[model samples]
Target: MPTTTALPPSVLISEVGPRDGLQSVSRTMPTAAKLAWIDALHGAGLREIEVCSFVPAKLLPQMADAAEVVRHALGKPGLTVMALVPNLRGAEAALAAGVHKLTLPVSASAAHSLANVRKTREQMIEEIRNIAALRDERAPGVKIEAGISTAFGCTIQGAVAEDDVIWMAEQAIAAGADESGLSDTTGMANPAQVQRLFKRLRAALGEHAGAAHMHNTRGLGLANCLAAYEAGVRTFDASQGGLGGCPYAPGASGNVVTEDLVFMFESMGVDTGVDLGRLAAGRAALANGLPGEPLYGMTPEAGLTKGFVYANGRRPATERLLAPLAP
Candidate 1:
C-alpha cells in the first residue's frame, strides 16, 4: 500500500478582491485606486491576483477598466496577473491585455448557467472549448482555469448533484481547460461537503484540479477552505475584506476574507507567503477605493495572536510581532 504524501505546509492565496469583490458592488473603483490596491497586495506578498473581468462595461460598469487594470497588474514584478472571462470574446480581450492566467467560470447548475451566463451547462462547456482553442492560437503560454460556479448548491434550482459537478470538471478538462476547480458560488457548502467534494474532484481531475473558491455567506467559508486544504487543495481564492458575491446567486455574500484566511494558515504554522500586518495595511486601499463598504475579517478586527510568525521569512520577527492593534 502506498502512503499518501502530506499536504504542503504553505498554500497560495490568490487574491480576487479586485475582480470578484468589486464586481458585486455598485460603486466602480477608479482605475488609479485599483492599481494602488493591487500594488499594496503585491507588496504584502501576494503573487497572484485576479485583477478584473473582461465583460462589457455596459453589463458590469465596475469592471469597465479591465484592460487598464490588467496592464497595470502585469507591470508588477513576480505577480501572476489573472483576469476572469465569460466567453471567448472576453478571453481575447484578456489575452490582448497580457494576463498571465484566465479564469472562465462555468456554472454547474443549469439554473445558474442560464441566469449568470445566459447559457446552458452544455453551451458553457462549448464556450470553454472555443476559448481554449483561442488561447492556444493566440496565447499558448497563458493558463486557462475553468471555475465551476455553484458547484455546492444553487439558490434557484437547489441541491446540485455531486455527479454533475464532477462531470462538469471532466468536461472542462476535456474541452481544453488547463485546470478545473469547484466554487461555492452560493456559499451553501459545509466543511464535510467541501472535503468530500474536493476529494472527489481531485480524484477525478488529479493534478489538473484547481483552486478552491469559497464564500463566507453562511459563516463557514474558512471552515470549508480548511476542508479543501486538508483534501489536497493548495491554491485558494479569497477577497480582501470579504467583499464579493455572484450577482445571479441570491443571498450569496463576499468570498472568504484574505486577511482571515492568511491568519488561519500562518497561525497554524502553515505559510501563505503573506504578511498580516502589510495585508491589514493594504485594506486602506479598500477603504479608500470603496468608502462605506462593509469589510469583514477576524484577524483584521482582533489583530494577530501575540508573537505570531509568518511562515515566509519576508518579515523580521520584530516586525511580525509589532502588527498594528486592530481598532
Candidate 2:
C-alpha cells in the first residue's frame, strides 16, 4: 500500500456568501446589511471574498449594488475582493469597479451552458477570450479565473463526460485566463470522482489550476473537499450557512458551509487563517441580512468539540469554555 502524506499546513478558504449565496435568494439584502456582513466576515480573518457579481440588476435584484459593494470591499486592507462577470460587458464593469479578481463561469455541460447563459460551449469560450483581451487592455494586473461550473454532472443533461470538462479547462487556459478551476454546481460529485477530476485538472493546468468549488446539495460536500485536498487542491470555495444554489440546476443546494469547512481543516491541524469563533459570529449578520432564510451547519449547532485547538494557535475551545470568569 502507498503511504499517504499529511495535508498541507495551511489552506485558502475563499468565502462566496455574498455572490453565490445572495443571488439564489429572492429577497435582496440591503446594501448596508451586505456591507456589515462583509465586514464581519473580514474580521473573522477571511482574506479572499467574492463580494458580488456584475450582472444586470433587472435579472438579479440581489446584486443591484454590485459596484458599491465592490468599492466597500476594496477598502478592507488585505482582502482580495473578487467578483463574477458573465461576459465582456460584465468584465468591463467589474474592471471599472477595481475588483482584485474576476471569475467567469464557463459551463462544461452544453445543456447547462444554453440554460444558464443562452450560449453554446464554443460561444462561451469566445466570450471568455474577449473578456481576457479586455482585461489585458484595461487592468493587466487584475486576475481572471475561469470557473468551470457543472463540471461534475448536470441536472439538465445527466452524466457530463469528464473529457468535456477537461477540454473546457484547457480551452479556458489557452484563451488567456490566469487560472481555471472546477465547480460542482449540481452537487452530484462523490469523493472518488472529486479526487480523480481534480488530479486531472492539476495535471492539465499545472500552476494555473485554481480553487475547488463544491456544493452540499447531496450532503457529500465535505467528503469531496477532503478528497480534493488529498489530490493537492489548496484553495476551497465555500459560503456562510451554506447559502445559495444554481437557478438553472434543479434541486441544487448551496455551496459548502464555511464554518464547517474551516472547522474541518483546523481540527486536522491545517491553518485556514480564520477564527472559528469569529466566523460563527458572522452568522448573525447573515441571519439579519436574509431574514427567514434557512441556514445549515454542524459545528455551529453542536459547538466546537471538547479540547479543540484552533489552527491559528488560539486557546482551545474547551479551555476557553472552562476558564474561570475574569473580573
Candidate 3:
C-alpha cells in the first residue's frame, strides 16, 4: 500500500449503519454481530462511526445494547466513537459509555419535532443545552453536534421554511452545541435546496456547521450530497448497504449508501480514506447478522468502473487513471 500524505482526509464519511441503519430495521442484531460489523466499518477506514442511539430499550429495542457497542468501539485506535442522543438522559448514558462525539437530533419542522421526539422545537433546544452542560460536567472532551432533522421538508409539515432551518441551526449553536448540521428527514430535498440551505446554515453557524444526512427515497441522495459538498459540508452520515430511515419520518427511505458515497467522492478526485472493497465486506457482515434485509446502493451492484483508482491510491489524483486493486 502507498503511504497517504499527512494531509487530512478531504471528506469525512461518518458511518451510521450501526445506529441509524439498525434502528430502522426490524431485527435486533446480536451485540456480537454489531461489534463485528463495526469493526469491519473501522477496517474500511471510516474514522467515525455512530455505534448506536441511547433511546429507552422499550422504545427502540434494537439499540438496547448501546453501552456494550460503544465500549467495543472505544477500543479502536484513532476511531471516533459517536452515538445519537435524543434527550439529556440519552446524552448522559452515551457519555458514561465513553462516546467521543454526540449527535442530538433537533427537528426543524415543528410538527416533526413533536412527533419524533415528543417535544416542541423549543424543548429540543433545551435538551441540547442540558446535554451540553452534562458533557462539560462529566466529559468535557466529548463533542456535541445538534442535527436539525427535517431541514429540507417534512412529510408531516409539508415544506420546512428555509428560514426555519437556518434558525434551528443558529439556535442549536447558541444553545451550546459544538456544531449543527442538516438532515433531509423525509428525503424530500432537491440538489438546489440542499445547496441553498447548507449555504445558509454555514453562514448562520460558520465553523459550527456539521454533517449532511440525506436519504435516497426519491433517488437524489448522491446529488444532494454533492450539492452539500459544493456548499462546503465536508462531513456526511451514510450507512453501509444504504441501510437507514427515520421510523417517524413517514415515507422516507434509506440514507446515502456508504459504498456509493465513498465512490462518488473518490471518483471525483476527493480522498475519503475509505476502501470500497472493505466496505463491501462490512455489508456482508450486515447481511449475515440480519438475513433477508433488503440492501440498496448502485455501486455495489454495478461493478467499479474499469481502471478505477481510489483518490488516495499510489498515484496522485492528477496522474491517476482508475486502476483496479490487484487480486
Clash counts for the predictions, in order: 1, 0, 6
For candidate 2, what is the total of clashing residue pairs? 0
After superposing candidate 2 on the true structure, give the runs of residues whose Cα lies further than 4 Å from its correct spot. 1-8, 247-253, 316-327
Clashes of 3: 6
**Residue pairs in steric clash, candidate 3?**
307-322, 307-323, 308-322, 308-323, 309-322, 309-323
- Candidate 1 residue lDDT tens string, 1-327: 999866548999999999998998999998988998899899999999999999989999999999888878888999999999999899999999999999999988999899977999999999989998988999899999999999999989999999999999999999999899899988789999999999999999999999999988878889999999999999999998888865334444568989889989887878888887777657988888788777777767776666565665444344331233234
Q: Which predicted model would earn the best lDDT?
A: 2
Error of 2 at 24 (Å): 0.5
Q: What digit string (tens of lDDT, one per residue) describes model 3 on residues 217-298?
A: 8888999999999999999999988887753343435688888899899999888988877676687788888887877777
Ranking by lDDT: 2, 1, 3
lDDT of 1: 0.87
Comparing 2 with 3 on TM-score, the higher-scoring candidate is: 2
Assess candidate 2 and give its lDDT: 0.89
Taking all chains together, each candidate's TM-score versus the true structure is 0.92, 0.92, 0.92
